[model samples]
Target: MTTAGGRPPRRLRADARDNRDQLLAAARAEFTEQGTHASLNKIAQRAGVGAGTLYRHFPTLAALLAALIGDDVDALCATGRDLMTHPDPDEALAVWLHAVAVHATAMRGLVATQMAALRDRRTAGALAACHDAIRAAGVALLDRAHHHGSAPAHVDIADLLTLVNAAAWASEQAPDDAALLARLLALITAGLRA
Candidate 1:
């Protein structure tokens, strides 16, 4: 493959397309079963491709790892944007938090290099874009709720939405993540109440 501007080289040929998809499937399964040590050779074999072919598609282990997690991250962020079209901001926020929890848990298993890239991205401009979008949605809904006397005057919409994601991350680390999240929502809404 060739590249410029961080895109995968030109359009993949049919054979290359099959190889790439196969590699992704193999890698996902291997990572799930064997954690980060899922060998490249094993993945290549599972995908019915040679190690050289895997390396050709992904020059390094980090490249492959980044590709896997990066695709998912892009999708998750897109979902955050799409949630704006939902009529209910609070419900949208809840769903976004849940999606983040799931994606975070899955990405946590990525190789160290890939994880660092993901971490760095959150500290960059992407974080601000995501945060602002969420806050805007929350403020709109919360303001309406306040007009109806269902939201507290002093509640900080920005801070509350931020806290929700932080709590969601913590919930992701727990064994009973679903139960933990249910409790978290109860506690948060209790505090955020009108």
Candidate 2:
């Protein structure tokens, strides 16, 4: 089966596959609980695998995070596909932007990792593919909204994404104040409307 980015799955032996899967599961838990700074050794221990095995599978924290979040990006693309069919273009764009914000802030420090991966040449291909997929999704939504004349002609997809990213970053800082985030997003959405 192909992975999230349509890359062919690595042909791993049964034991190796098991190790990789365990490592991913453990890493997800550890990262979620401790942020991106979580210890790799603890992750390896949690997975019941040796440090060597973890290193063999994922040489760097960025690689592990990229693998883990690729699935989320794919799901975001699926959300965009579904939003395309919604009857109201403006509402669809608004909802999709909200989804993007949620995805960005789902894990602490994910936005930073994503930004880093976008800049780092070595890991850029996979992460850029995911980023581009999300941008394409946003572009589709923006086009629909523009065609419907609900969104301002001056609005650009990249600008919209940047706005959402900023809101997501704010949400990360004050996670308990979800109402504030919603209000801020609503204000931004309102500004986009014609």
Candidate 3:
């Protein structure tokens, strides 16, 4: 298979592919438990691989983060797809927005990592692709709500995402307080309604 630029996909040897998968799995677990600043050496150790092997697979932390966040964005988009079949457009939008907020704040410092990735030139392109996918899903939900007269016609996808990010930031600040996160999301949902 070829990529969008028409370059053939680089196929890894079976062992190399296993190593890469292990590194990604270890990195995900470490990042989730210890945040973005988690030690790379520890991740390598958890994966039962040498530090050099980890570096060989992912030369930079940003590269590793991009892969992790990209997977998350895919899952979030899938959630949006599943929500589309709901009877109420407003409810679907609300549920999807809440899911995005949860995903954005899933790990300690994840929002910060995402913001940094979005700004870093080396990682920006990959992150932007993921963000664009997410935005497309958000647009679908927003348009549905607008068509049903549940959301304001003037509201756009960006507006809803901004609110979602804010809620995610707030949730990060009070990670132990699920009620607080729920309340904040509820307020945002109410505000988005027509």
Candidate 4:
């Protein structure tokens, strides 16, 4: 964002960037809990910034959402390496898959918002890159599991990803989340073994 002054773009100073980051972080938690309908004012207050600042950075809710989803997808993709260090491939996949599930469920109502962002070709590109990053993580997890000689070679990483994503979406309907997820994982893992 530049002014007509031919100077550098209106770069947010380190402190302002920090403020923006903080606001976005708060917005993430708030959105996850309450969704896009969460209180933007509370997000600002939680970030220790004025409402005006939040409005300045994100004029509409759509802007804030794209930022949050982008942040989450990026962070989750980076977690694959951390999972690889785990001693148990099964356990590693379990945790990472649950995270992916949570990530999908977190966007319960965000698809519409994301669509608007996607209309901006740049944002769509960013979103695709984000998905690809997560897909790479899934591939790595599959490879690590194979290396451990745990899951059978025939098991498809894409299938696991679909299961996790579906479970995440279905979780909203379950009363016993832990038991449900455990049962789902067990069924999937059994199929892998077979």
| C-alpha root-mean-square deviation, each candidate | 6.1, 3.2, 2.5, 5.5
Model 4 regions lying over 4 Å from their true place: 1-10, 13-30, 33-63, 107-123, 175-178
Give the alpha carbon lDDT tens digit for every residue of 33-122 in model 2. 877568999999999999999999998766777787889888989999999999999999999998888887756766445654575557
Candidate 3 segments whose C-alpha is farther than 4 A from its true place = 4-7, 115-122
lDDT of 4 by residue, 96-192 (tens): 8777766776745353335434435566554556566777898898888887847788777767876776665565568566577667766766666
Order of all candidates by TM-score, from best down to worst? 2, 3, 4, 1
Error of 4 at 170 (Å): 0.8
- Each model's TM-score, in the order given? 0.58, 0.85, 0.84, 0.62
List per-prediction Cα lDDT, in the order shown: 0.64, 0.83, 0.82, 0.72
lDDT of 3 at 79: 91
Ordered list by lDDT, greatest first: 2, 3, 4, 1
Backbone clashes per model, in order?
Answer: 0, 0, 0, 0
TM-score, cand. 3 vs. native: 0.84
Candidate 1 per-residue C-alpha lDDT over 120-177 given as tens digits, one digit per residue, 9 for 90 to 100: 5444344334434434645665665455534567877656655665565566568665
Q: Could you tell me the TM-score of candidate 4? A: 0.62
lDDT of 3 by residue, 8-80 (tens): 9889999999998999899888988988678999999999999999988888776677677777788889999
Please report, as a residue range, the 10-residue window in candidate 3 with the lowest summed lDDT: 111-120
Q: How far does residue 70 in candidate 2 sit from its true spot (Å)?
A: 2.1
Higher-TM-score candidate of 1 and 3: 3
The TM-score between candidate 1 and the true structure equals: 0.58
Poorest 10 consecutive residues by lDDT, candidate 1:
107-116
Candidate 3 colliding pairs: none
Best prediction by lDDT: 2
